[model samples]
Each structure stands twice: as structure tokens, then as C-alpha cells.
Target: MGKNTQDGTPGSWFKITIPCGGKYDKTWLVNSIQNHCSVPFTPVDFHYVKNQARFFVQDAGIASALKDVSYKICDEENQKISIFVNPSNVPYSVRYKLEPEEMEQLKLTMNKRYDVFQQALDLQRLRFDPDLVDHDIDIILNRRNCMAATLQIIEENFRELLSLNLSNNKLYGLDGLSDIIQMVPTVKILNLSNNELNLVWELNKIKGLNLEELWLEGNPLCDTFPDQSTYISAIKDCFPKLLRLDGQELSPPVTVDIDTPYLIKPCKESYKGSETLKSLVLQFLQEYYLTYDSGDRQGLLGAYHHEACFSLTIPFNPEDLAPSSLCEYSKESRNMKKLKDPYLWVQLLKHTKRDIVCALGVLPKTQHDLSSFVVDMWFQTEMMLCFSVNGVFKEVEGRSQGSVRAFTRTFIVTPASNSSICIVNDELFVRDATPSETQNAFSIQVPTPISSSMSILSQEQQEMVQSFSTQSGMKLEWSQKCLQDNEWNYTRAGQVFTMLKNEGKIPEEAFKQIP
Candidate 1:
């Protein structure tokens, strides 16, 4: 069959014949042509008939060159089989295929349009290039495939392209421009004005560019917005670093220097009250938590005032780090901001020491980390003292057992009978522990118990006492006595040592190591 070229001239057709019974395909023939011929050309309308393949070429020079080359196709036998490329009787037409000559013309045209000093390639109105017009090759950027080919050429040759002007290209969509970032990621300025782009979303296809300047004033998408500011705002959302849009200067983007080091004040307890009040609060916390973490919740009955009120709050939206099961506390969480129902609020709150202790018993058994405590004295007066303790705790035995939690507990205490203070009001807030909090919780080494004739103590119990003594700088006898007084609990033992040490109540001999 005969086909005509773009200029109404008959294209040159050639038939390639290989050795009969030889194992060969069209790809083998194409590779052979590329290997043998010095000039580059694509086989248009390629098809096979038996053991022969016929193809058309628009460029007469490439067709003549192909005929002169001694093409050889190697078969399974490793024999050099001669392949013949002879002019065919049938004529063929070249539709969209660009021959070697036309490709060269396109490259020459691009070279003329490129500014080497500025590293900019101006491809606007590419279809009107006089050089490409003679070869009947119209470079249309609107065609995705055509645009891709053009970009491939630019990426191979002008790799350092920093600015590209693709204006007046009649581009309606940016699908062809999606890979522009990968091709030239450093490109800072882009001109896409005078195009047919009508939707703001089309720009999303090229969102990753670190473009500092963009030109889209003449596009239909610009007209869709109500005003210039709206257009600028919509475009700026796609490119945060854009400093100029359509020749207008935009405000420089506000960016944080993430690389700069920031000074984080060390975490420590804050006490705004007098030293006497501070010591009192510390002692009270040490005693209260020791009993609270014990097996018996009823032991805390005297710690609370007769009419003490207790309530618990948790975050409304828990994070992924939260324990998988929060059923233990979620049902009782009385966050006043989230739980607006006044009746439920009154029902969840515990009034009086007995009610508070019962409510605490229903919750999980816990082991509080004394070292993680960060106490803050909020207010103090002759009548009452208010303070808050933030710390981490582990659920020792429950449905959420082994999971760590961070909590903040606030207390309002007043002097009770016998010169003792009791909690008049208590509020507890719980949340998932942060990564650092979980790591730092209970990290301190407990003192190790000294070898003695405490035959009843288990090996684990001895180790706990020894660790506590080592950590508290107390002799083994005093450390064991302290741990025994606190039910052999390391956390409670350490807390008692700290309170006694701060109050000057510990004897000087207690700090001495065992012989």
C-alpha cells in the first residue's frame, strides 16, 4: 500500500527481507537498522508479511542511507544472516512521525530560542517556528505526547534549564507538565500565561516545583477568580514559595528555620510558695501516693477530708499512643468542657473521703514513678494550700495492664485535726504518655538491700531493698526499714527517703553504706 507525506508528497517505502526459516522479529529488524545506520529514523506503519517487513520513511536521506547499509540479523544458530532493505513498489504516508531531518530542525530551532547565559528556554508559539514549518512539523505543547517528547529533548541537552517560557501554547491541562519538576527541579521561574487552562486544579499536577515566580495572568483560570487577590491567593496555595505572580510582586513567604537549634528549658518542679509550704506539700504527696499505690485503697481514708471532692478528666480526642483499651477510665471521665450535662457531672464526682476511696478502688492498680513527678505550688494561704503534681504511672494489673499513662493531679489541702493536713478537693487528668515520658518513667535505680538475716524476704524483695538503699544513699537497714514500712514498694520507699531527707528527719548514720 502507498502512503503520502504531510506535504502531499509520496513517502519512500522499503521492504526488509531476512533469511527464510530464521528466528527474527520486527524488534530485531529495528535494532539492526539502528546498529547499522548512522542516521536515526523511526519505522512508520511497520508490519510483517511472512518473513519480510515493510516500513515507510519520510526523510529521503534516511531511506537512501538505509538502502546502502549492509544490515545483518543474527539468528539462534549464531550465523550472520544478510538482511536486505530494498525500495518497495508500494508508497506509504507519514502522518505524525518526525524523520531524522525534522528532528534536527526542531533541535536547531530550540537551540536558537535558548539563552545560554540566562539558562532560559523560550518555547512560546513553538508551532510558528519558521524552521519547523519547512519540515511540516508543528510543535504543539497542548498535545501531551508531543510535549513529553519536547521535554525529553530538553532534559537530555539543556539539563541546567532554570527558567522555561511555555506561554501561548494553548495548553488546557497540565498533565504534560507534571514531570517538569523531575526534569528540572531547580527551575525557579515558569511562564504559562496566554494558555487555555480554565481550572485551578490543573495547576495541582505541577505542585512540587519550588518556583519563585510564575506567569498565569492570561490564562482562563485567572478570569475564573472574582478578583486579582483571589487569583493570587488560589495560585499561592499551590506554590507556597512563590514570590511573584503575573509580573506582580507578592509578599515574601513566612518560613520557620527548622534547622536552627532551639533552647528547651529543662524540666523541673516549680514551687511559688514559701519553703515551709513547699516542704509540707512534698511530704504530703510522698505519703499520699505511697498509700494510693498500695494494695489497699482504704488506707487513704485519713488522707482526704471528710467532705473532700474528687473528679477525673481525660482528653476528648485521644492519640494513637493511648492504650488500646481505655474502658477503665473513659466511662468515668468527667471533663467538664466535654461533658456538658450537669446531672452526669454531679453523678461522676465523688463527695467525701469514703466515696472518693471507693471510686479509686474501682480503677486499675497502679505504680507511680516518684522520679517523674513535677510538683507546682499554685496558691497558698493561712487557711488552705493548693498544688498540682504532673507525673507518669504504669497500670500494674488491669485490662490496660503494662501500659504507661501521664497524669496531672491537683489538690486543695487544709489543716485537719491533730495538726495534720487533708485533701479538701482533688482533680485528676489522664492522657497517653509521650515517647519521652514513657522512656523516662521509673528510670532511676532503686537502692540494693544489704545481705542480712531477713530470711522471710524473697530474693526479689532483697534486690528491691538493696536498690532503694543504693539510690537513696541510705544504709541497708534504714532502706529495708523504709521499704518494709511502705510494703516493700521501691517507689514508695524512695519517696519516703526524699521527704525525710528534705525535712532533716533522717539520721546522719542512715546515709552511711553498709560494711
Candidate 2:
């Protein structure tokens, strides 16, 4: 009864119903119904007086095909026969009959090699029957020659499944797995161990899943790592919020900084600066931008240290043409390749002041809006201060009509002998503004100016707040709040921070600073 047809297509049983009360030709109805079905089937025995007809559908997922056709039994009532197939209530000969398109989709998904799905279908049927007690439908180690299509079938039908054990199934890769991950987000525990996966990068397709535990032991990918510690890095990178991997319980990082002062609604341009470092960076940027815009080669001669390196990368938009001077720039331009060039390396290694001057002079004149600036500064080492400046610079005196380009410049400032700081390493990236960004270029809504004295703090007190914020890993606004809350006493603020940190009440967002 389970044998395939001449074309190697599988068969399922379905019951066809029609009205017998009216003058209907039973022979014609059966012949027409069989021809109307999308997949060919053989009708089982049935009398003309008896309206019930059964068929062995030779093709999968054709139960819904019978519903698409219409046969008028009589004009008085306009009777329409609708075919309904229930998988659980099939005749004694047919063990499993797919219900409709939805259930057929699940039944058709099982790999045909092992026929383990025949067992899975029975298990699924029992789960849906109200008379049966609830049980787990864990599809483990069936070795059904599984593939991405198999997972897709399971995702459509078994979304409520919590644990799935597909280990020892000879699964080579997880292509098209994102569909399952998206469909079955409720899957918390998954075991895919002892498979042939060669890289963990395949797991990156799965995003926004609440996966608590994942198993990939005995895979070729695991063998590539020297130890569990090395492999865990890949796992953590792909699954940022995962709690467990390969049966090992992982501890999440303490992202909340307890010692950091808290600020509220801080200004974008505000810097959590140290007294000497912040002033030096701000002053350097102020003078640098002015000289950059002046288009004078001599003005930029003193900004770089003797051993400094400078490189600019332009991420051009496909729709926007590169300037005439920067003709080689493209949408895919990156400094990584340019830095490796021996010719460019020689110029940067020599740190020729004239070369730096000429490089800056050849570019179109730019007017950097300091008010739109967003600054982030941190000390990489005791002797080195690193900072990144992000803002929009308008290209003026060009063929284009003052197109705005968003720019980011990262600088490693080391203290010069004369108490001033010069950039030791300067990396710059410039890109055309997106449509939304171009529209919102000047539409930034700043915080309403506060009348509180916190806005009117002395330069020294303001620097103190910045210092506190930097040292404590807190936001500038939250640091202001702490200073205002503790009457500008660093000692009292320290105590308050300790209390909050001990109680695990510090907000995680305070530690995040946009670059």
C-alpha cells in the first residue's frame, strides 16, 4: 500500500465526498475528479448510489488539489463536493494520510532515504490527538539523510519543539538554516554534534535566536581549534548572548561599570576628557580643520610627528562620482591595501612633513562643522592618548554643489617635546551621506539648555566631571548628575557609585559610547 507509482512518486490515501441525493452520474464524477486532481491518482472501489469515493494519490501534497475543482450535482441546491483528508482517521490499509496542504507540507519534508519520518508522522499524530497524553517529539539520530529542506519542513510544523537532537546524522553543512532559525526561535536546546561542519562561520546566519545551549562537539570545525577556549571565541562572536556551548556553562561579561559616574541626556560634542588630554585634542582639531580648509600646503607641516603614518580611505557611493583629483577612489576603496603598498609605506615611514602638507592640499577644500562633531577619547597606554572624531564636512569649490561627506578621523596623539601633542598615527575615512543622513544633516535636535548650574560649572569643575566620567566608564551626562547629586565631591560620588555597583543597579547603557 506504501509502494511508489510508475514515475517513482509516493502515494497517500484520501476520501472524496459528493452528494448522491441529486441526479449525478457516479461514473462521470469519478473520472472527472481523477482528471481534475493536480497529481494523478487511482480511485478505489465505490458504488454510484454511495456518494463516498476514496483514492490513492500518487503525488505528495495533492490533498488540497481536489478542493480547487467544482462539479455541479444539481441546479436546485448547487451541491459542491469538498475533499477532506485527515491523516489520523484514514482507512485500515493506509496508516498515515496527510490532512491538507499545511500538514502535507510537513509530511513531504522528511528525507525519503531512511523513512524515519514515517515514525515521526505517527509521533506527530499522537501529539495532536486530545485523547493521548503529551510527549516530546525529539527527532534524534534518525539519520534520515537530512538537509536544509528537511529542517524547513520541521520549522513549519514543529515550532513548539524545545529540544532537537540531530546528532550523528552525517549532516555536512547548514545552508538555508536561517529559515529554520527564523521560524523556530523557540528552540532553546539544540544538539548537532558529531556532524561534518567544517566552520563555525556557518552559524552566523542564525540571528535573533534565543538559543541558550548549542552543541557542536566531534565536528571537523571543532578539530580546527586548538582547544575549547579558542573555539568559544568563534561561538561568542556568532552568538553574542548565548549562555552555554558544547555542554559548558558560560559566564556573561559584566558589562555594567559600577565605578562610572552617571549622566543624563549628554551633549554629542561633549568629551569625557582629562585636563591636559582633552584640551590638547580639542585645540589640535580646531587648528587642524582650519588649516585643512585653507588649502595651504605649509599650514599642515607641523601636525605630524616624525614617525607618524597617515592614510585616507574613501567609501564612495556608486551613484556619486569621485572628485577629479581623487580619480582612483571607488565604492570599494579601503586603506588596508594602500597601507601595504611599499611606495606609500616609504612615504609614511619617512613621515615627510612636505608630503603630508601636499597630500592635504590636493584634496578639495572642506568646511568641518565642529558643532556637529561627536568625539570619543580613551588612553590606550600611559604615554599614548587615542581619539576618534566623527562629523560632517562639506566639500566646497568643487564641480558638485557642496555635497556633504561624513568623515571620521582617528588619531594616536603622543606628547611632543614642547608640551604639545602631535598625531603619531592618523587614519581617516570619508563617505557620501545617505539620503536620510543628508536630509537630517542639520536637523539634529539638541537637548533643551538646562538652567541648572551644572551647565555653568567652572572649567576646572567641568574637567573634573569629564575626568570622573572617563575614569569610571560612565556617560558625560550621568557623570554630571553624579557630580550635581554629590555636591561636586569626588569622595561622596565614589561612595554612591560603590553602593549602586554593589547592588547591581547600574544601567548598562552608561558604559556605551558611540564612536
Candidate 3:
């Protein structure tokens, strides 16, 4: 009974009917589709009726594919139930549109539900309302059409609406709930208890609502979590401002108020030592990051002491909004506060240069934004150097490709043979970059190199070539050639040098100092 277009393609919407006997829930249907269907598809919206389910896909090809494999899916009794993939005869807008008389009746019903003094609308058990039942009208909040119409009426009449209770409404999906955040912006207390909502991700539909109280008790999603603490944690992830949940008063959220007035001086990037020591630290960082960002991490074996120590740490809260993906490094994280086992503490630490380099090889390829780097020297002595560099970097390849992350790297180094410094201890902490950081990342322009006469260059340009040589660990001749190739632009020259170095195109003598 499925309808086809003039070209014999199936319609975008299809309904599947099965005999009402066994408990065929939404989770079962989703699993069956994922397991049996050969073609991969994501439904835009799904609705469940008493003995039928409707699926709205993006195109007709997916509809045809679903129809072809519909019979392959079996029920709890292992029997292939008959299915009718028919195009919804009525267009969605026409189906949900209310008649003039019906609109007036709905308005009247909503007026009865609204409490003007309390500024609350109690729409629980709306389908069973006596007035609606008398008028033979059924308003199911789970259906997108009904919810949209209800919110439209509330927006027009109740501009000051503060609280909304939508409990026991057989609601499984909140497709139209985001409108409340805009239409009823003042509404802070929401009650969605005793609903059929299952997946925790469904809460993402209304994630930005500034609600102080939320009630989601008696929902299927609550039981799916391992324990009550986990349930609360998951809910808090969605609603960080929630103070009360399901009749339980939660602890106040901890947050930093960056705008608070302060009398003390602000922290500025500083190196308390002399300029000579500062220059050494800068040169070291410039060389180390250049090698670290290169394709072959084995090249860094000489940068670390034979008995150096290295460890990585991540935020303890897995749901922290920062880093997009942490699974790649979470297992090896040596967070001292959370990791209490001494055995694990020793095992996670990389002790030798070989082990450290090997471990670094497994990390995703990265391109650091050197322009965004801020360094501060913590301690300086004849025996050792201690400092930290904070900056933004992009993952160029691997599971978290293209993700921008903020990182702080602390290094403890000591003088080694031949005037080189080697890392004695290193610690790296990574988190999600702030909005400003992500926006300004990699914004520095790189100019193309063009041949120009040295006589025409400015004093600043000549000085830049000398500085690039020291910072890049490249011979003066090679540094000058790189700058000239990049039109005498210092940033462009550095970027080109790094690219050539990573690709193994630069000669070894280019990085060595000329006699």
C-alpha cells in the first residue's frame, strides 16, 4: 500500500503496522532496524501509535530501502509480522492544523489549566481533561504537532508564564520543547515526571534552558543508569544550573566569576630571571615544539634525559565541556588526586627516553599555534630550569581530527652535553579551548616568499632574519633563505620551515650552527 512518486520512488514518510500482542518497545525497534537493515539511515523524527509506528526520513531512497527490509525484522515470538509502508496520506501541516472552532475550544481549555496568581500552567494528563474529553479532543504532548500548537497558544496569552508541569503525558520525545526556552523564557521550574522518555540524550533538545528546578522521576531513562549518583551526574551534565531535581536539593554549582573586581595585580606572562635566561627558555621551547609537532616523534629522543619522567593529566570530570574527545588519553592519565593506587602511579609514568618517545608516538598528530603561546618562567638556577607554556593546538589526524584543544605543558630541564638542555621532568594537561581561543586560533597570516634584494630590506626585516635563526635552531644562511623565500615575512618563514622539516625535505646541515 506504499505510495510512489511519478518516477516510482517511495515517499519520504512511511508507516509500519504490526499486530498488537507483544511488548515491542522503541528500543527494540531501533535495535532491529540497526541490526537487519543493509543501508544506513538516520530518521529525522519518529512517532509511536498504539499498533503502528511512523518514520520520517530525509529522502525517498531510504524509504524504499526500509520497505524492502521491513519483512526481515521479526517480533518477540520470532515471527515476521505483516507491515504496510504507506505514505502518510495527509500532509503534516494539514494534519496538525486546528479548525477555527477547535482553536477557540483549545484556548478555553488552556485558560482553565493556567494559574494566573502562581504563573504556572499544569498541563499534566491533558488528554484526560474533562472539557477536552467532552469535546472529543485529544492533545498528546508527545506528538510534535500538538506540542507546537499548545506552545503557540501559551506564547500569545501568557507572556509572563513562569512554571510548567507536563507530567504523565506519555511523552517519549521532546522534539518541540526548545520553543519553551524562547517563547516562555521566564519559565524556570519544569516537571516532566512519569513520562516514557528513555534516552539521556533526549534531554539535549532543551539543553540551554535556565531552569532552577526539574522533575524527571519515574522515567525509563532514570532506571537505565547504574545508580542514583550516576543518574544525578548525567542530569547535571545536561542542566548545570539545576538546584532541585526530582524533589532532591542538589549542591550549589561551583563556577568562577571572571568579572569580579579585584585589588591585587593580575597575572601577566613573566620570566623573573635575566633576559639571557629568558632567551634560552624561548629557544628551547621553539626547538622542542618544532620537533614534537613533526611527523616523526622519534626525532625527540635526544631532547629528554635518559632517566626523564613524563606523565599526562586530564580533568577528573568526564563530562567537562572542554575537550571534545578524551577516550584516546584517559586510560594513561596519571591524575594523582583520582589515581590512589601507588602501583598504577609508577606504571603510568614513563621513566626512560625510549619509553617516553614510544608513548608520544601513539598520540594524534598535532599542529600547535605558536603565536598563541604564553610562557612563564617559574624557577631558574645554574643546575636546572623550570617553566610552563600554555597554548592552543589542533589535532590533524586520528580519532579526534580537527578538534582544537587548550593545553598547558610544564617542563623541568637541566644542562646536558654540548650546550644543549634536556628535559628532566615533563607534565602536560589538556582541556577544551574557550570560545575566544578557538575563534582566534591559527588566525595569524602567513605570506608567500618572493625574491627581493637585500639592499631594499628594512632594518626590522634584517633583524627578523637573525631572530628566526636563533628561534628555529637553523643556520643563519638557511634562515635568511627561508625568510627571502617567504617574502621576508617572519611568521610565514617559520611556518614554511616547520612544514619542510616535518616532511624531511630540509637538509640536516640547515639546523646546525655554521662555524
The clash count for each model shown is: 16, 8, 5
lDDT (C-alpha, whole model) for all candidates: 0.70, 0.54, 0.71
Better of 2 and 3 by lDDT: 3
RMSD versus native structure for model 1: 25.5
**How does model 2 score by TM-score?**
0.31
- Candidate 3 CA-lDDT value: 0.71
Return the top candidate by TM-score: 3
Ten-residue region with minimum lDDT total, candidate 1: 254-263
Q: For candidate 1, write residues 369-396 as lDDT tens digits.
A: 7767889976766667788999998898
What's the TM for model 3? 0.40
Model 2: worst 10 consecutive residues (lDDT sum) = 256-265
Q: Which of candidates 1 and 2 is the stronger one according to lDDT?
A: 1
lDDT, candidate 3, 410-464, per-residue tens: 9897766545667889999988788999877765333334456445667887788
Q: Give candidate 3 misplaced runs (Cα > 4 Å).
A: 1-90, 256-515
299: Cα error in model 2, Å:
1.7
Residue-pair clash count for candidate 3? 5
Worst 10 residues of 3 by lDDT: 255-264
Ranking by TM-score: 3, 1, 2
